[model samples]
Target: MFCTLLWGSAAPFIKWGYDLFSISQTGDILVFAGVRFLLAGLLVILAGSLLQGKLLTAGKAVMTPVLTLAFFQTFGQYFLYYLGVSQASGVDSAVITGTGAFISLLMAVYVFRYEKMTANKALGCLTGFAGILVMNASALTQAGGSLMGEGLILTSQVFSAISAAFIKKFTRTHDAVLLSGWQFACGGLALMLSGLAMGGSMPGASAAGWAVVLYLAFVSAAAYTLWGLLLKEYPLSRVGIFNCIIPVAGVFWSAALLHETGQAFAPSTLAAMALVAIGVWLVNRPETPDKRSENQTCGS
Candidate 1:
């Protein structure tokens, strides 16, 4: 819940960051994102080291996992997401982003075989997805999004799903904090270089812009580290299902911070929130003894 809320708050803050930094170009967006994640990584490493009374280390054995996560989680996901959001309608982006939980669940169930694909899980995802659509139904009625926009957003969710699986796998052996820090650092560096190569610049950013960066960095560091630990100890379905609340949180925060309060109080918004809550409950609800026994019998 805390992690999802932090992540959700990022939507409005990011918008503020772009406006404050006067960033509109793709390369500039990448550069800004790179700086944010780079700082986030350093913050995590410093704080984590202090907590454990030693520097967090990522040896050669963990380097592969770190790099793999960097590519899919940070670089691939955000790289495409920023570009996609710029091209897509806000409604379209919101709907596509909602698919993340579903995609992550699919990867956990099928790609990694980390969990069984149960009926409740499928229904939960469908219900949560419906909530997202309901919240955006007003704008969704208009049809005008490009393939580059919608397609890239969908692809970014796929990358996000892949990263979730890898995080669960790697955290079994490596320090979750170490993995989170190094992967963000490596991914940020890649984005920085790519942005530079593409002629991105942030020469005129003010103090306020930098402060927003700091906040954004903290959001990523704290949320990702905590979320990694959760994944370390719990099933992917259990942790991933909570992500359904992110969009709902986004709406509330956007209302509070951005003064988009009208929609936040609308009937559709309330209905959407209720649906999301129900979906989350369904997904995280404990399995019945009958179902467990049935599964055991089937396996036998």
Candidate 2:
């Protein structure tokens, strides 16, 4: 829940950064995101080295997972997410990101086979998705969502789901924090290179602006680290269930923090939130022994 809360802070902060730093171009946003993740990666590495009292070495197994995670989870996901936020309202972005829960659930059940999909699980995902549709229906039709906006967020979140599955598979071999740190470093480097290639230039900004950037880095490092630890301890489905709270937190934060945007949320949003909460319950609820026995019999 705490990790998800930290992540929920992202959209509003990114919007605020763009305004504060005068970031108009997509390349510029990429550069900013790159810097944030780079530092986050470094911080995690430092923490790991300190805990071990020695420099950490990256072998083939470590580098393989780190690089893969960097590309898909850190670099690919954020690239799309930042770009999507640029073209969409913060509230819309938040609501759209809520889809991550469903994506993660699907991956957990089918791809990783980490958890079996029961009737409750299926209904839970459907209910959560229904909430997402309801929450976005007004904005998508009235305010309009472009391919660049909602589409990109949708794509990135699927990558996030894939990353979760990978993390679950990899953590048994490597230290979670170290893997997280390196991935963030690799991702940041990749993003900046891409941004520069795309003609992004970093301009001088206010000290406050830099502070905001650092805060973002800090948030990424802390949130991802905590999440890495959680994945190390829990099943992907369990950790993923908490994500249902993120969009609600994000929309609330955006409405509260970035009020100048004049985003008027509808009463239906409240009902939509209720639906999502219920969905979380359904997804997270433990199955009965009888249900598991029935499932095993069916499989046999």
Best candidate, TM-score-wise? 2
Using lDDT as the measure, which candidate wins? 2
lDDT of 1 by residue, 1-300 (tens): 999888777766776777788888888888988998899999999999999999988788999999999999899998988777666544345445666887888898788888777778788888887876776676556686337766787799899889998999999989999999999999988887788889997765999999999999999899999999998888787788777767677777767666767766778877877887787787777779987666445323
Clash pairs (backbone) in predicted model 2: none
Q: Could you tell me the C-alpha RMSD of candidate 2 in Å? A: 2.5
Q: For every candidate structure, what is the RMSD over all alpha carbons to the true structure, in angstroms?
A: 2.8, 2.5
TM-score of 1: 0.89
The lDDT of each candidate is 0.81, 0.83
lDDT of 2 at 264: 30
Model 2 poorest 10 in a row by lDDT:
260-269
Estimated TM-score for each candidate: 0.89, 0.93
Count: clashes, candidate 1: 0
